[model samples]
Target chain A: MLLFLSFLAIIMIASSHNAESKVHEIAKLNNEVRELRTHFVDGKTELMRLKMESSIVKKMMQKGLKRPERPPRKIIVKN
Target chain B: MAVKEKNILNRLYFIAACMFVFAIAVLVKLVNIQFVEGDMYRQKGQERVFKTFDIPANRGNLYDSKGNLLATSVPKYDIRFDALAVNEKDFRAHIKPLCEALSKEFGKSVSYYDKIIRTARSNKNRYLLLRRNLGYSQYMRVKKFPLFEFGANRGGLIVEQRTVREHPIGKIAERTVGYERRDEQGYYTRVGLEGAYGPFLRGKEGKRKKQKIAKNQWKPIGDANEVEPQDGFDVVSTIDVNIQDIAHHELLAQLEKFEAEHGTVVVMETKTGEIKAISNLGRTKTGRYYEKLNYAVGESHEPGSTFKLMTIVAALEDKVIDSSHVVDTEDGKVKFYDRTVRDSKWGGYGKISMAKAFELSSNTAFAKIIDQNYKNNPRKFVDRLINMGLGETLGLAIKGEGKPKIPYPGDDDWYGTTLPWMAHGYGVAITPLQTLAFYNAIANDGEMVKPRFIKEVKTWDKTRERFDKEILNPTICSKETAKIAQEMMKNVVKRGTADNIRTDNFGIAGKTGTCWGNYGKDKEREYISSFAGYFPVDKPIYSCIVVIHRPNKKKGYYGSEVAAPVFKTIATKIYNDIPVIDEVSYAVVESNAVVNSYDKYYQNAQKYKTIMPNVKGMPAMDVVALLENMGLRVKLEGVGKVKNQSIKPGTKVKINQTVRLELS
Candidate 1:
């Protein structure tokens, strides 16, 4: 009878441990998806900024606008 | 001994019975766990492990009829935080650097970020939205931030994909196409073409079943449950982008030059009423062409002389007057009630043909004719106009088409003077498009057609569903009446009020309109000047209208002065750009010289001149008088009526060299 009680206790312990392992695994996957989302957000913002600038530059070119020429600079001492 | 043996046997049976009961109970419990109650635990297991997430599909792209991209959907992302994943003690310690990083990434203040984070954590929102519509790079930088370096799910940060609307054409036709807004009903609807055709423009939303592994953490189920989204169909518009650009540019220039309160330029294909270009420019309070009001469809003022075309058509249809029928224009003015209708000038034009009356825009002659024809029966004329499809909303695919208010004799708004006032364009309101459509019907051989903007709708690949033109009526007038009306309109551009619109390239025929607007705000009677016409009078292809509203005196307020030139400007370019059925040919009508006095002028300057005699310093009245006698056109231009001429005075010039005369 004592042996049977010991075996039943062993089974309960094993099942509870399995449940714990499962919770850990779910946490790990949750972390992965969250990390991926952050990466995606950063990439999107950079793309939008670049695209907006590119469109502006393209419009300027279409209007036949040229870059402004640099003027000669004179050296000055602190006054 | 016998009792002991019996007791042992009963104990054995009892033990067997107990064992059988235990075995049955165990079997029943296994069955319940394995089948009947299995789903409950399975659900519980899923709650512990699986997660669901939304996958936002891309918004559809909007394209022009020529497949030019007008609007499109670009992918964007939302940044979020999962407060439960990080330890509460460490959350505060890490919050400052995270806020600083987010501020730098989003270019917002650090305090704003800090406040959002503190509130989010306090609320215990597992996934709190930090910022939406972040670009890919911004999200990546946020992900790589030192405190957030731990992967998203582990570090309690998230980035979700979404789509943002973009206008590829920018503000071009922005008001017409319209926009989408989420209304109070929690439903999204389109405002313009974007709104009207939104169902066709917005692709169907896809669905997915996902498991929620942790609070606010979801992962998509098997591919079987994930539905692929169908993209929205594209709307192909009737608007030609090139022509639209030209109209926008030209209308802006005219409005600026005229310093007008507002203006609209509409170009429609004569046969189909397929609006090719519609440009509406309104001057801001600062007197600049930057207002967004759609004057073409919204403004419903008395169309004035432009509406005279309808009266004339009605007259021709009733056979009240023939093209050559002559009538004295009441010596310029006639008293009808307290209101006196005049032929523009106070004194009446001399004896003129019906065609000449149309050209000169004799208000007295038209009023007299309308009085004679409709005096006995007003309803027939009103019904005739209604049959021609005026005074009612066109029910165009676009919304907000205003209904015309036609005052009838018995109606509450009608008065005895309504006929005369309505005769010369008053006592009623009609939009620019409605007026154009009426003239368009006349030009289209009396066939009224529904004006359309969206020509075709398609999928991403051009599997087209072409929209056939809606022909509302076969003919509004008899073939004879139509021909007579066409000739009358032709006379308008040839020798009438709009004669200055004549170009060497194409023959134009239409009407000029000038009317007091904004309730005759000034006693001096400033006017809304407009010209509506179609080109190549022989086979009409394109009809256009140019309206300049409330121009200052410096800009020339007459329709013939301000609007006619804009019509010419646009028509000339269209004729040059688009191929027409017939090539322009000016058949030289040579006339026998009444006197050869100009022969010496041509003979002396023949060599120095490029081709023909340059009649510089010649009086325009005399030059036109002589040229019309000799069958030639005198292209006049400038302020004091014929200043310096383009060709040297008295220099022989080629017929092709445009003779520019300054005219005040």
Candidate 2:
């Protein structure tokens, strides 16, 4: 009976330690998720700023590309 | 001797009685502490080790209609230092390298960091701020610095993280996007979309119980929480980032050119009444511009000549006037009892049709049109405007829509002059958005749709609610009247006051208005230049409005000069930006070159086995395959069909011999 009690006690201790390790792992993962989110926001903000139309026009002006003065034509083919 | 012995025995008895009493007193105190004070001690011990915590739910993100981030809550890092965390020897050894790293990363002078650190160390400042509001990458870079990498207990690096609202688009629509804040008295200041959708964006918080395991560390006691957190749903607004960017820049350029006090522009989808872009800019004392307020939604002022559209629509629908009816300008000076109205031109336009009167925006013409036609029954004109939905607010999603006021026949401000003055857009008030809605209706074939900002509220893929087009009125005017108004507006750009802003890319039909504000002698009069219209005279898609207040009088201040250019640019750019689809017939036609090659390949495969077959003129591909199939290895040397072979042709079938065939 005494041996059985000690075995049960050992199982309880092992389980507690397992739980503690998981807690530490969760804390580390939470920190990593936050940092990744921060980096993602930074990249997205920069992309939106660069993709803005005004910025694109300014960039293309250096290469001599500008808005056309005339409207585009629609072509239709008859069979 | 017997008497002395007796006295000593008596003293011994007295001493024994005292010892017995002292022992009894000790037992009583022990029982008291164990039974009576035990509960208080146990409670104190429990209070130190266990706690209940409130876990905050993650706030939802705000997104544009194109699924781009408008506003979101992100973790911002503030780094602090514990000056005396390290011993004197360690501090001395690593201080120079630590300061050097900080200088390199943050672009501060080395002496700046050195002085601050030394001062902090001498003063024993436990919480010295190193950097505040560092982004994630910057925080990690600082964490990897030489001395700070040793961590909190030793190197004394402290980090405090909290969530803050961030706008990815910067200051483009900062005022319209807005935020929510709570004061010390627990009052929330809600502004714009965030404040409007607080219930959906702010989810329910959760709770959990934990036990203290180490200093400043708590271990959750169980896997399940007492209450689970519900994260906020993402809010998608109907703001096209591309259009917003163009509108913002175009308005800024015009405002800077005119050195205007303030300006506002709004572009809305005519069919659905979706506000695609809106920009409001105010000038600073130092000649800079920023999004100062939501003037498009909140500011109500007299719309000078743009109001003429409503007047014409009312008259045409009332069957009181037609485009062909001629109205004499009479030198462009017309009097209304006490006030005199004059045209901008010196000699005034000669007798012209009502259509010409509208295209030129003659104040006397419209004044005469409404005054003479409705003078007997002014109530008819006022009721016409009221029925057109111009005497009330738009009932917008965001708060603070300026109320539009249309004077009635018996109102306190009503006078004999009010009829003609109101004809020329005076003694009247309407928000810029309201005027755009009216124009948008004219573009939508008289179907008046309310302006909408939010497209939907959703969580991931499941939609909580969807917003559809809410029609305010079936028709603001008859189809015939709307057509006439559209044509006249197109004429305004084609050969009218706004001719300076004509573009070949698309047809812009609108009216230009330049009104004077603060006209009394006590204050200097300022010019409010505005243009209101829609584009593509054939089929209208979007209606836009631009209002610029108090432009410099020295430079041009007419609506044609200051405001119409912005309208034209926005319309032309938007028209050119729409993607066009081209169809290319993709029928597979068997070419002659392919068929000949296939026939050659088949003929070469039929014959030639285990013996030398004259393959000199044969294609390299056919030759290689023909030889290799008979248990020989094949190798190709060059490209396109085939050219030459290393071994003559087949010779004999070998188990593993490489045939180097060259291709042309």
Candidate 3:
């Protein structure tokens, strides 16, 4: 009986400790998610600013590219 | 021992009595504790362990019409240093390198950082703020630098993260893509699209119960939260980022060139009235320009000659005048009650048709026509404007749409001169967006649609709500009346004040409006130059308005100069945005002669080196190669294939000898 009680106590202690470690893991993962999200949005904002037409025009100016002066045309073919 | 056997039989009574008193006292104290103090102790134990916490849900993103992220919620970091966390030895060993890295990152001098850190250390300051609002990458870089590499406990690095709303396109459309903020009083201050859709953008908060465990960690007591948070639906606005970029820079360039105080431009689809792009810029005290306010939506000012379209439309609809009737301008000016109406041209337009009067935008001609026709029954004219929905607001999705003013006959401010002045667009006020809507109605063939900003609200792939084109007036006027107004505007651009902006690329029909701001005031005069119009006169696509206020007088303040050019620029760029597609069928050339001759040359050049292999009836080009590659000089004298060869097949060739090949 005494040995059985001792085993039960050991199991209780181990289980509580396991739960604690899981909590720590959750905290670490939460931090990681926040950091990763921050990184992703930063990259998205950078890409948007670069993709802007004004930014593109300014960059392409060094290569002598200008916005076209006239409207683009669409041609239809008849079979 | 019961008081030492109760002092024998005689003392036994006294000892029993004393024991009884002590037992009674102990029982009473136990009862008091069980009844009264139990609740207090239970409450104390509860306070030490468990807690209820709120879990915030992620706010939804704001996307442009094409799924480009306009605004989103992201974590920004603030870095602080705990001076007392690191030991003296560690701090001393890495302080110099740490200061150097910080100085390099923040662009401050190393000495400045060193001084501040040493002072903080001496003052025993634990939370010394290094930098605030750093991006994640910058925060990571700072963490990996020198002493900070050891992390929180040993490196004294402390980082605080906060979620903030971010706009990726920066300050270009900051006013339109606005923010929502809350103060301590729980009052929300909302602005722009974010403000307009605050409830939809901000998700619900979840509640959870947690138990305080060891090391300051709170372990969740249950597997599920008491309340589940629902993430906000993503709002997609009807904004084309390409067009928005074009409008913003074009408006900025014109504002800078004119040295204008402020300017605004709105580009709306003609049929649906969906706002494609809106840019509002105001000059700073230091002579720089940024988006200061949503002037296109909130500013209601007198729209000068652009209002002539409405006057003409109203007159035509009432049948008071025909387009062919001629009106005379008295020199350059005419008088109403104490006020004189004038034209921009000194020598009047003399005698011209009613359409020509509108094309010239003559103030005196419009004033005389409206006063002569509508002065007796002014209520009819006012009611006509009201029927056109001119006096009401646009009922925009966003807040603070400016109130349009059209003076009524019974109003306190209405005077005898009100009718004529209103005809010349002086005694009236309307926002740039309202003017664009009216012009857009004409472009849409008398269909007036409400200007819409948001397209839909979505949760992932599922659409929660979708917005459709809302027609305010199906037929604002007869189709012929809209047609006549359209023709008059077309002539305005084709031969009138705005003829300077006419282009052969695409037909732009617009009206120029120039009114002096603060006229007859003690302050210096300022010009409010504006142009309202639509493009591709035959099949209108987008209607736009450009308003520049307080442009320098000497730098050209006329509407044609200051505003029409901006309108033209935006219209041309947006028109070119449509991609040109031309179809061409793919064909494969079947010229085998070129390939065959090259193939033979390649083969013979390899086969014959020291001796000739076979050169019979081969092409002259191949024959020359067959002989020359064998170390013999060859001379060809024909355009066709080789008919005769001087050397026989497989004959051994001598170096530096000449061979003749004849071709047919």
Candidate 4:
């Protein structure tokens, strides 16, 4: 009876530890996913900005050297 | 006494027998507990609880030399459903809204989602994969929906993470970098630079066990066991990005301007042979072109009159002909083996110097030089050409570089007319890069270095194996011979055929080659107009070649007319961009021609001058004195310093003529 109780206790500890590790991993992955999404969005924004500027410049060139209006800077909040 | 002793002994024996039976029962009970029934008790005590999913490791990113992202991985989500866990009544009721949300997010119609959900509903034991690679934002929005808001497990919805590839500067250097694809063998592969350095880019794959919740559902057990991916090293190219942009634009413009089918322009560093800009493009019906082929090394065409530079060099190296050594043109047509090779303009160009013949791209002249020297042994000529790096394959970093086509005597393809035609850059085919390399060799003071595209192969650790410039040799001539050949080419631009490139600011020393090719159909003449040159003429820095093939008639498709101008435009831009190190001597070439115009202006000034005004602290007196010497009159008035003068110093007057003088 004493040995059986001890074996059950050990199994319970192992299962809890496994679950703990899995939860920790999920949390870390969640952070990575958040970071990647932000970066992807930023990249897209940059591409759009470049495209707009290039077309503006092209139009300006056609008009014989007029300056294009710069686009407003996006304000990003940091935690 | 005997009866009493017997009774006691029997009682002791029975007691001992009972003790042995008790020990045997205990032994059997211990065996059953420890060995036979142990597994059942252990199974009853443990519970197989929460399962895990193994998250796939994200792939590394590829960056360019300037820390610009070439390719990168972005996080994407996959939607899955655990059919077994989903309550049938509640699931069926919520299924329509869920499908509608999926259709909205995926940009698909409601019917498509219906079909997908219908099939997924068929297998209750399985976790159905709804979609793969949804954006994180899309997933977040979908998760906020009322039906999907109950969290993943309760609603039986699952999201798995994956990485997607992205190019920051799409289509720039696309062909050279290449793409990755899975082949028929089920193995993933990459091509070009990406493929060549794939191992470094791929990094190591991390392993982990995932808990299989359902047949298809898995939850990662631990920290997506991150063997934190080491990103691919940045490729620092020898190419100057600005120059590459300029070359691309100019090459495209020239190709279309000539209505040429396709063309390539490679601007390489003179000494290092580091290709700064290589623009290889093929034309399309849309007018805009794509980099469909690496024509700079892949396409080999007879380089036409440009090949004359080689023949001239060979002849000069052999001491068979000097720059002044005249070759007979006769009728400007050479009939060898019933094949008449005539100059484009026809009729004899008179008995001109060898330099003039080269300048005019005279076929007959080079034909005479080749026939006179290498005719007895054609292999000797071909061998000499090969020795000059004509037919050799340049072991460049990029694969599929063509083996340069050159004819040799006794080869099955060789004909009687081969030597003469080869002399004028025909009957033997070579790529634009090979021809450019040969010219670049001459420009590099006769030291031939193989053209290098990749400057370094960098590893993941940021350590680089630098590909230093390899000098093949001092080539088939002494520096003197190379100089003479270079100067002869310089004269071609200075006064010869390529004078169209001459600008007041820069001197262009180069050659023009216009040749007709069969293209696809036999004997349908299509011209390949090309100009190969280096500038500034005094000190060579850049050797550029512009080849415009099959230009429409409207574009005036001559090498000088089309290609030389492009060369000038690109050279001018390069000159403006690069620091001008050595100043080109812009002194008059012909000193004896005239001082007469300047003398006439001086005489007119003398005829206009008169003066001898008040000479005391008067501004006008200076002018008066100057006018006095120049035979002109001047009247001086008020002065702090030459404040006023009546007659200007330049006013016309006879010698010793008097004029009024005034002072303030």
- Which runs in model 2 stand beyond 4 Å of their true positions? A68-79, B1-51, B86-97, B212-217, B222-225, B582-664
DockQ of 3: 0.52
Q: Write the per-residue lDDT of candidate 2 for residues A1-79, one digit (tens) a residue.
A: 9999999999999998998899899999988887888888888888888998988888999999997655565544333
Model 1 segments beyond 4 Å from truth?
A1-79, B1-57, B76-162, B184-189, B223-228, B462-464, B519-526, B579-664
Candidate 4 lDDT at A43 equals 65
Per-residue C-alpha lDDT of model 3 across residues B499-608, encoded as one tens digit per residue: 98898878999899998778784988888999999998898989999999999899999999999999988988888877566765555666898788778778878766
User: Candidate 1 residues B1-664, lDDT tens each?
Assistant: 5679889999999999999999999999999998999999998887676644454444555666666655666556787888778886667678889888888877899999889777877888888888887665566677788557876656887878755666555555666667776778869754556777777787766777776656666655565666767768878788776666667777777888888888889899999889887888887788777537667877787788888888778777777778788777767987787777777766888888878888888888777778777888888888777777776877777666767877777998776677877877877788888888888888888888877888888876785678878887788787787777788888888888988877655689989998866554356657899999898788888999988888987768888988988887777666656543334455565654523535534453343324334555554665554444443456777533346566564555444345566765
Q: Which is the better candidate, 2 or 4, if ranked by TM-score?
A: 2
What is candidate 1's TM-score for chain B alone? 0.69
Model 3 segments more than 4 A misplaced? A1-22, A72-79, B1-48, B87-93, B122-124, B214-217, B223-225, B521-523, B582-664
TM-score of 3: 0.85
Better of 2 and 4 by lDDT: 2
DockQ of each: 0.04, 0.34, 0.52, 0.04
True contacts kept of 4: 0.01
- Across B533-612, the per-residue lDDT of candidate 2 in tens digits comes to 99877878889999999999999889999999999998988888764445555557799977886787676667665654
Model 1 chain B weakest 10-residue run by lDDT? B604-613
**TM-scores, in order shown?**
0.63, 0.83, 0.85, 0.65
Instruction: Write one digit per residue (lDDT tens) for candidate 4, span B176-257.
Output: 5565665789586655555655555565544554555666655555445434434454454565555665687777777776
* Residue A18 CA displacement from its true place in model 1, Å: 23
- CAPRI class of candidate 2: acceptable
Considering the two chains of model 3, state its CAPRI-style docking category.
Answer: medium
